[model samples]
Target chain A: MKIMPCPLNGPRNISEFVHGGEVRDMPNPTTCTDREWAEYVFYSDNQAGIVTEWWLHAASGYWFIAERHTVTDEIIRTYDPSEIFNQRVEFSDETTAKEVGA
Target chain B: MSATSPESLSKRSFVYRQLAGASFRDIAGGAMATGVAEGNNNRSQAEQSALLDLSVLPRTGFRGLTAAAHLQAAGLPIPARPNQASVTGSGELVLRLSQKEFWLLGALSDSGAGVDALNQRGLPAADCYSLYCQDSHAWLALTGAHLPATLAKVCGVDLREASFPLGSIAQTSVARVNVVIVHHQLAGVPCFSILCDSAAAEYLWESLLDAMGEFGGEVIGSNALL
Candidate 1:
């Protein structure tokens, strides 16, 4: 059986994990065009070489980032999301935007 | 003497329907199986290989960025790292599923007083929130000598005592269903405590029993464990 190393639970059977799409930078919803937002939410680069992607360990409900080689289907490394997200992200309200515009 | 019936309890086990022949007694606000038949070899069966339902027992969890600090402030001992567990002085099992998530399991001897106390206290910090494991997960205990071998039939993890060790936790799939397994002991008898989705309780219980049939494992009551 293929094994995937989980940042929180150590090595486990690959069947216990679910692919959660690629890791991509988010375009500020308030400033980016609708098209840009759509692309961010719906598209992936699908690169041929090594890529960072999201994975979920179904049992623990833990989500982490994994760098894997697309062509060889080899998992290079896995790490906790905390390494990338140190602080919480907050979205500004429409009223705040209007106040700024005023 | 007569024992309480599960049908009479306000709270019942997720697999209560499957416990038709077992004797029941009040515990943790629900009916727990005490024996299958009077004068039967339930204790012996448990010492060899047996499965016990603990779905109605008290269990609670907390998670978020500040959960660890919150639990520590409440005077509970926290594991130093994720996927580890610590037994409390009062016999409660504290499991650190992740850096920010901890689950408290009430000790059978106290009928879950430790967990219930924490649940009653409520979450005081906004960064930490309560996890309703009592309602969302079904708990089961597998005991005795053949636990590792029986689990090997359906689980891919290496649960042998040498590798898994006491207090080690594994969040993995068993029989293709998600489950959290903790290597723990009950009344000095080593056992594995399994927590799984409430909806899959019956299915997993039957699956485990089927896997254990070859080793003479059978359903046991909480009396055997205590």
Candidate 2:
């Protein structure tokens, strides 16, 4: 049986997971043109080489990313998304503008 | 999270009638019973070492970033890794299915009050998580000296005491169905609780029985585990 190393669950049978497709940066819908958005959704660099992709552990429902070689079917590494995307947008709790005439 | 009603779409165990034999009574919203099979050797195995149907046992499911915090606030200790389990002071079992998903099984201990307290304190400010009753799965508890041997027939993971260990859980397949296997103990002996889709209960049950036939597998009452 093929084994896949899960970042959180350790190594497990490959069958316990689902391929989540290539991991790519999402184009900002507000600024990107229709053509760019369409390409982002439909196009992929299918050449045989190392690629980063999403993978989901079916039983645990944990989703993460794995870098693998297409030609060798070798997984180089697996990691959680939070490790790479740590910065998040948060609304400021305090107001920026001062009261004009209290 | 608001308490959701049990889903009508949820399935009942196909072995329900078989499980509802003598001494069976209505509990946990399902038929309950306990007894040894007549042909089985009582001297061979300790009492309470048998298969228990916990399909009707109440379960709560939760997932997302704030879920662990939410459960911690509800009184269940969040396991540091996926496929790990923790027990509440009141005997409730909390199993982390994945990085952000968990299931709260058994009802003796409750963090409902803690959830209420969290809500009162205005925690979980956004829609950062989700929680609901898990009525879609069937559960069975397997215990006895022969448990590992029986499980070995179907489960691919090593389940011996030294390897699987107590309180550990695995997200693996058993009898061709994806399930969660938690290694627990009953009367100081190793026990495993198998959770799978309710619709496949009968098939899995029969498969387990087939595997256990070599070691005198028999259906015992829910009280054995409850």
DockQ (C-alpha based) per candidate is 0.87, 0.41
lDDT (Cα, tens digit) per residue for candidate 2, span A72-102: 9999999998877778854332322222221
Q: Encode model 1's per-residue lDDT on B1-226: one tens digit a residue.
A: 5668888889999999988878888887799888866334357777788888988779999998889887887789999989999999888999999988999998988889888788767676488898999989999999888889999999999999899999999999999999999999888887999999999999999999999999888888888766
Best by DockQ: 1
| lDDT comparing candidate 1 with the true structure | 0.89
List the pairs of residues colliding in candidate 2. Answer: B33-B221, B34-B221
lDDT of each: 0.89, 0.69
Chain B TM-score for candidate 1: 0.95
The residue-level lDDT of candidate 2 at A32 comes to: 68
Kept native contacts, as fractions per model, are 0.96, 0.52
Ten residues in a row with the worst lDDT in model 2 chain B?
Answer: B1-10
RMSD of model 2 against the true structure: 7.7
Query: Which pairs in model 1 have colliding backbones?
Result: none
